[model samples]
Target: MTLTSQLTVGVAAFDRYLAICHPHKYALVITRSTSNIMCILPWILPTYVILGPMLGWRNWYPGIPCSFDIIFPKSLRATAYIIVYIVSIITAILYLPVLKTAWRYYQRMNKYQQNQTRDHMQTTNKMKKAILGAKVTGIVTIAFSIFWLPYMTLSSWIMVSPTAKSKLESDLANWLVFFGASNSIVNPIIYAWKRPDVNQQFKKVFCGSKPVSHVEHIKT
Candidate 1:
């Protein structure tokens, strides 16, 4: 929940980067109304995709999956689980490429190999908050893979299987779920502590001062 909201906020920051920091193309490509629509997509899509679907799907299937209503009948919850799992799988596929590309950019930048001039290096440094961003993203994916993915898969099997899960196994999962949900809060905290520029920009952007404009890429 918080993770979705924060990602939406992060996208807003990205839009600001493109508009203020990359004004040349931004000027050519986006009018204020179009920019407004672009900015809304992150928040709007999730609301429609994740939240809306879940709520609406509950009418068809009387239970919510892996959520508070998991205590409902097996048949009801099973359908809900399938719905949620499909959505989660789609989420993973979309983000996997994003994460891979960010990692490559991070490695290339840190290696000092991206056709850098002095001014170019400075601009890249400022714009690429993505190393830390990628870390956060990777961590979320890992958590999803570990905590949710297998559970969803197994539960699908459980939907059919007569063999019941032992108390120890279910207990362990219940205990670990909090750690999985911690990803959202953890990302900001880790970035703030480890990345000085991100911390500064974060304070500048949200703490009353005008945020620094997104920097243009420098020509060599």
Candidate 2:
């Protein structure tokens, strides 16, 4: 589930990159079918990693039920972490151009704001929203990195340095695992904090607010 979440976030970042960097081609490239495929691919790609032990690609540790430590070899586990880091790097790369473009748009909007017509105002409003959305996504990405990096680094260390494994390290790894899992809990809060629509729906569902009609909008 964590792997799927990370990959889905990466896909979302990529989607925003396209929307901000290549607005003209984004509509044609990111259709309904394309969106479906993007959604499915994240889940599908992680399945193999999750199911590798059951599929006999790796052996589980004896007397330790379903532990990640011995499920895959040290080399394979290290490789998986490398893949995850690559995804993180790529997500960061995609955001750079988006931030640049958003800043440029903001400057242009501000320059014309005093004499702006209705159409320009609307465009400025959209640019503001887009900038907010990008910041929200960036926050989520940073949160993922904060929560997962310690666990990944520790786990990789344990795998690579078998002699360094000790009760202290094991306990630390366990705590870090929980810390990483907390990202799942943090994500919805992040979304609600930055997104008014999501915040409103959260209130309506959890706080017994009245139903409000809203058109669904994807930030990116």
Local accuracy of candidate 1 as per-residue lDDT tens digits, 1-220: 4334344444433444343345467566677887787667556644654564366554445454454334345765565565555545555555655556555666877798657899877656544653444444445445445644554554565557777766665665555545556555665675565545565587787896655443332111
Error of 1 at 197 (Å): 3.9
lDDT of each: 0.53, 0.80
What would you estimate as the lDDT of candidate 1? 0.53
Where does model 1 exceed 4 Å of error?
1-132, 147-154, 163-170, 193-195, 201-220
TM-score list, all predictions? 0.45, 0.85
Largest lDDT belongs to which candidate?
2
Per-residue error (Å), model 2, residue 49: 2.0
TM-score of decoy 2: 0.85
Q: Which stretches of candidate 2 lie over 4 Å from their true place?
A: 54-66, 162-164, 203-220
